[model samples]
Target: MFRHKGKGRRYSHNLKLASILSGVAGLVNITGVLSVNSLTTNVTGHFAFFSEQLFLKNYEMALIYLLYILFFLSGAFISGLIIEWTTKYKPHSSYIIPLSIEIIIILFVGFSPDLIPGISQMIISSALLFAMGLQNALVTRVSQSVVRTTHLTGLFTDLGIELSLLFFHHQKARRKQINKSIFLKLMIILCFFLGGILGAFTYQHFQLKTLLIPVGLLLFALWYDRLLIRYYHIKRKLR
Candidate 1:
């Protein structure tokens, strides 16, 4: 689900990845908030705080928010860097590698609550946000920028436009397009919501261990894609 460039699977690889990642993202976001008392999946809140702090001339707090935003950007940058660096050495491993890194980051976050329980909230939030940034970039590159997972800003906006078309536009040809768009957005939103619920309930009981839930989802996707690719290659060779 993290590789290839086509209408993969039944609907499309982009939709598949978008659905899975969006769910994982929603899980991380809600659990991160409960753990760190902050949102880590997107920079929207941080941007507002940054601007507010800057306007108030609170350089210290403003700088903190600035760094937080930069950390998210750094995650995206690092994801692209890892992809490019590995591309030449391992052509087929581009997308998988960054996801591996995300898995590692989540693992760290998961363990932090226990192993390093005293870690600062900001530090934890930064790490979670960084993972989200990496995910957003990886999905964009792998999905050819067709979807994003970290936040629903663009998804909701597009969803609204598609909703209007699905309701107002009666052309059969265009209706299919509207239907597809609507399905994709709704799938993401629903998966995200379901993941959020799982995250909330699990975090309530399992605490930091809840992160492993999303990690498991990511690993399953990575492994499934690899297995599918390998199976295809084997079949081709046999033929």
Candidate 2:
């Protein structure tokens, strides 16, 4: 139900949606990290780090990190499976489905106070990971591979290198190239950090129930996408 590009007046709308999505990703990462001691974003790095730790005699820390990595991978695998299974019926999938599922899991954890210690955290982390994967994939697809909402490490690194090139190298073409990359990279970093701050505060004060904001954002994304689709159809008909 989403379009990669919007027409004329709606161009700005797409950018706004991307920003909101990035913010949601940030919030999820922050919440997951604080509550679960795991990262929902950038599981690949987590995997590599955990692997190294495992080899270095830090078994406890490695196990915990490994769990996070596995859960995140599980999430991505689930998303991929869903897409593969539905490809025949639906050519494209909306991120709202997985996001809704993630919210449901969060609510369940929030309401059931007893579910925290044992296997509940693992399950919740898995759900969060899956939601993040779905979100990242959706944005990548919708933006035609131009945007990523989760895991700002690479984004920050890219931004740094781009800025360095912009200042150090006097090549005008290279400067223009680096500036655009830096802008989007910075945007992702800021959105994630802002989301993280909000998430940390919410979780600290409210506990596991702080996912209402992200749920609301998902609903809004669905509604906004529908509205834009309808607007496009109407305009096309008029022409």
Best by lDDT: 1
lDDT of 1 by residue, 1-239 (tens): 66675554335776788789999999999998888778888999999999999999999989988888998999999999998788789767788778988999899989985778688888888888899999999888777787788898888998888787777889998898889878888888888889999999998788988999999999999888889889999999999
Please give the CA lDDT of all the candidate structures. 0.86, 0.69
How many angstroms is residue 68 displaced in model 2 relative to the true structure, after the best TM-score fit? 2.6
Model 2: what TM-score? 0.77
lDDT of 2 by residue, 82-153 (tens): 545655576434454655666675566555556554546666676777677777765665565667788776
- Tell me each candidate's TM-score: 0.93, 0.77
Q: Could you say which candidate leads in TM-score? A: 1
Model 1 lDDT, residue 3, Cα: 60
